[model samples]
Target: MEDNKVDSKKKRLNIVSAIIYIPMFLGMIQFFFDENYRNDGLGWLLLLTFWVIRNIDQAIRDWWDKKQKSVLFDLLLAAVVLVFLIIRGMEYFSS
Candidate 1:
């Protein structure tokens, strides 16, 4: 049935998202234990960027499934991520 198809798609999406999250989680653990990442602010910033991007993707998917999407919330998330990327880029270039 169509319902089964939709459920399967959702399950697949969740599986894929979990797979993507694993690397980010491992990276954070590595970042914490690694002295080099501690010394380099850029590394920390890059890790944060990846985390934000992953969350943004999830948010977009969630909004897509809803009948009434909140444009303001999505736009705010985009803006914040943009500002974060800009700051991280500046830090990367400065260093």
Candidate 2:
């Protein structure tokens, strides 16, 4: 029973992660190809906001489970993503 519960929880988390990531992936693709979308910050902002909100639970769980190593990795990943998003936003708004 305990194993079943753990398996189910993992499956649920996987589904949730997919749900959150797939749209972001699509949005990034669109932003790359669509000139109008690239010039608008709202879409990027919405995607970034949704990503953080959706992944916060997983991020916290990862931090709690692995302590310092996972925290460092998470922070690094976040910094990269944030930098990319900020750069894109700046490019969009500056033009």
Candidate 3:
């Protein structure tokens, strides 16, 4: 039962990862052709979105696992992601 639960959780996480990364792969392809970020940067947006989502997910998982030290590390990572997310958001929206 426990093993099944773990497998199911892993499968869900894998699905989430694929959902995030498939577009990232597409974005990378688009990035290589144009290589211009001044006016448009969907790739950068996608990358940032993936980072923040992963950070938050990891933080939540660590908290649930009762791993205090790991959770702190995850929080620190989340802080970094938040800073970048804010900066990129402003740039994306303002332009």
Model 2: CA > 4 A from native: 37-68, 75-95
Q: Which ten residues in a row have the lowest lDDT in candidate 1?
A: 67-76
**Candidate 3 wrong stretches, greater than 4 Å:** 35-40, 60-66
Screening candidate 3 with a backbone cut-off below 3 angstroms (N, C-alpha, C), the clashing residue pairs are none
RMSD of 1: 2.8
Query: What does the lDDT come to for candidate 3?
Result: 0.76
Cα-lDDT of candidate 1: 0.70
Displacement of the residue 77 alpha carbon in candidate 2, Å: 4.5
Arranged by TM-score, best first: 1, 3, 2
Going through the candidates in the order shown, the clash numbers are 0, 0, 0
Across 44-87, the per-residue lDDT of candidate 3 in tens digits comes to 66677667777777877777677999989978887897898789
Candidate 1: residue 52 Cα off by (Å):
2.3
RMSD of every prediction: 2.8, 4.6, 2.8
lDDT of 2 at 88: 73
Better of 1 and 2 by lDDT: 1
Best-matching candidate per lDDT? 3
Task: Report the alpha-carbon TM-score of model 3 versus the true structure.
Answer: 0.68
Per-residue CA lDDT of model 1 for 1-95, tens digit only, reads 98888888888888887888787777666766777754456557657667576657656676657723554565567678778888887877786
* TM-score pick, better of 2 and 3: 3
Flag regions of model 1 displaced more than 4 Å: 37-43, 67-75
